[model samples]
Target: MIKILAVGDVIGRPGRQALQVGLAKVRESMTPDFIIVNGENSAGGFGITRKIFDDFINSCGVDCVTMGNHWMDKRDIYEFRDHPQIVLPANMSNVDDPAKGLRILESKSGVRVAVMNLLGKVFMKGENSCPFAMVDKMLDLTPSYVKVRLLDVHAEATSEKQGLGQYLAGRLSAVYGTHSHVPTADERILKNHTGFVTDLGMTGPYDSVIGIDPDSAVRRLRTGEKRNFEPAKNDLWFYGMLFEINEDSGACTGVHRLRFPAKDS
Candidate 1:
């Protein structure tokens, strides 16, 4: 069995620190063969920076980093988007976007693992293509040798996520949702062996509103004013999912949720 670790969105500094503190424990306990993290918000609750990306890979030992709608919020990303460890959404309508949406990586056990990022349009505002079609194209583009495939569906609507998960049931090893920042209770393996989860939740402060400072988030919602959003500092936690896949068949045999609170600073 190949153990795969999928971490949720990292909010900001606190989130990074939480990973710095908790990832080692997870690694020691679970010993995952591959580690993938949603790093769209790793910079400052907006987008990821090159320095932060390096920290995730070099310091936190992340093998792959996936992004979401906030993929372009930081300027440094343009310089590092070509990095093999990072990937943006595949369905982006902007043909000029240079970042790749799908990537195939080799795990520690020499298994080829295909990872793809996709965006949902149910309630999102963006010029993106159909996620269903994009996924199909990505699967076709992936080499036949790669059997362990994972998709990060960064979307707002649960229905869209569930639909995509069901659509790719027998083809993918796992289908996980992000962007919601709130973890869901439903996690199961479909009859076809695809592991599914609506949302993996955020790996940042849990005491605030989806990693944002509660006061600022409330002000923007209540007064309709644009306020500088900051990442929350309290109640730090690390949220993710652990998957056990059969290497030969590329079928998920176990799906486990991981929620670890950060040590008191």
Candidate 2:
């Protein structure tokens, strides 16, 4: 079986620290064959920087980093967009990267895996392509040798995320949600083949409003201020999902949700 861990969006510096601590604890209990994290908000809760990306790969030993609507918020991303560990939203309307939403990677145990990301149109601001159509094309183009396939649906609506999970139930090994910053309770196997989750939740300061400072988030929300937001500094948390897949059949055998407070990590 291939063990894969998918972490929720990393909010900011606190989230980064939570990640390192959480990884330390997970290593003490169980080691994952592969680990992927959504880091679109790692840089001051807006977008990830190249330096943060490098630390995630080199320091945290992450396998892949996924992004969402804010993928372009950090200009430094363009410098490392081609890096093997970075996975951008495939259906992004203005994106023209080489990965094309699908990346074939090798796990620590030498199992071939593929990571894909898609942007949703429901309640979103981009003129992105149809995620369903784009995913079908991506799967068709993906090499057959890569069996363990995983996708991160960076969406806002729970229904849209769940619908996509069902749409690719038997085709993909796992279909999980991201971008909402609130983790959902649903984590299960679909059609006895695919692992599904509504959302992986936020991996940062839970005390704040979705990782932003309480005062700043409310200041803009209540007063319609245009000032930049800052990340919260306390009450760190970690959120993620773990999936066990049949390496040869590319079927998910087990799916579990994982959450940890700063104290536990």
Candidate 3:
């Protein structure tokens, strides 16, 4: 069995710290073959930085980092976007973007896994190309040696995420959603043996509104003012999913949602 760990959006410093704590426990209990984290919000809840990316890969034991709409929020990303361990949203119509949308990485056990990042259009910013079509192009581009595949659908609407999961059920090993920052209860294997989830949630403070400071988020919602949002520091937790795949068939046999709260919490 090839076990893969797919983590949700890392909010900020708190989220990164929570990941370190939670992943330590996971490693002690049952180490996964490959670890994938959504680092789109890793840097101050905006975008990832080189330091955070290194921490995730070197310190946190993450094999790959997936990004979302905020892929360009931090200017430093441009310097290291070409890193093979990072993947950005593929549907960006801008062909000039230096970062790639898909990557095929080899696990320590020699299992080839293809990871793809995609953005959603519904209730999202930017002119995103058709996710359905883009996914097809990505699958076609995947090399034959890489059978196991996972897609991080960084989307807002559950419908769009579900649709994409269904659209590529058998073709991909797993399809999981992100960006909502609230974990969904639904997790199941599709009829075609692919694992699916609406959202993997956020690895940050659960006490606040989606990892933002409660006061600031509430004030913005109540006053309709564009208030500066900061990552909350209380009640930190790590949200993610675990998938057990059959190496020969590239089918997901087991899907489990993971939520590990801070030990002190």
Candidate 4:
């Protein structure tokens, strides 16, 4: 059996702070073979920065980091386009995007796991190919040695996330959603031993607006104004999921949501 710690979006400062505080403990308790985190909003609550990505890996001890729509907000990320550790959306390169969609990592036990990143179309713009179709091609091209295939599907629509889970139910090891910053209640092993979840939630302040300052989010919502939302300053929390896989078949044996108590600051 191989244990993988798959986490949701890590927002701005508060998110970073949460990881800084709890990651080591989580690693010790979970004893995962690998750790994959979503760093799409690891930057300033909107995008990820190189420094943040490095911190997630070096400081937080993440084995792989996947991204979402906000990934493109940082133009400088293109420099690490070819880096094999960071996984971007598969369809992001439809018109010559630089990042790669999926990443594969091999553990010392000879288990190969593929982490694929994709974006849903329910509420997002069309800047690439169809995610459903992209996933199909990716699965077809997956190497035979890789038995554990997991997907991080980032989208705003719950329907889209559910649809993707249904679409990939029997074909993959797991399919998880991100970008919402709040965890869903669905965490289960599908019919074919595939794990699925509507969303893994965010790894930041539980009291804020998706990890941002509540006041700013409210102002923008009420006034239709654009403002810089800062990371929240109270009740920080960390959220993610853990999947236990059968090494021989790469099938998921169990799935569970992991949450650290919210910290009041």
Error of 2 at 29 (Å): 0.5
| Candidate 4: worst-modelled 10 consecutive residues by lDDT | 91-100
Q: Which residue pairs in candidate 3 collide?
A: none
Compare the candidates by lDDT and give the number of the best one. Answer: 2
lDDT of 4 by residue, 53-159 (tens): 88777877788989888777787788775677898888754422323676788754667889899888777876667789888877877887788989999888999
TM-score winner between candidates 2 and 4 = 2
Error of 2 at 3 (Å): 0.5
Q: Please write out the lDDT profile of model 2 over residues 10-107, one tens digit for every residue.
A: 99899999999888888788889999999999998998998999999999999999899998898988888777778889889977332667888899
- Predictions in order: lDDT: 0.90, 0.91, 0.89, 0.81
lDDT of 3 by residue, 179-210 (tens): 99999999999975899999999998899999
Tens-digit lDDT string for candidate 1 (1-265) = 9999999999999999888777887977879999999999999999999989998889888999999999999998999888999989978765224237888999999999988999898988878889998888888788887889999999999999999999999899999999999999899998768999999999999989999999999998999876878998899999999999987888999999999897545
What value of lDDT does candidate 1 attain over all alpha carbons? Answer: 0.90
Query: TM-score of each candidate?
Result: 0.97, 0.97, 0.96, 0.93
User: Per-prediction count of colliding residue pairs?
Assistant: 0, 1, 0, 1
Please give the RMSD to the true structure for each candidate, in Å.
1.5, 1.4, 1.6, 2.1
Better of 1 and 3 by lDDT: 1
Candidate 2, poorest ten consecutive residues by summed lDDT: 94-103
Cα lDDT for residue 110, candidate 1: 94
Residue 176 in candidate 4, Cα distance off native in Å: 0.4
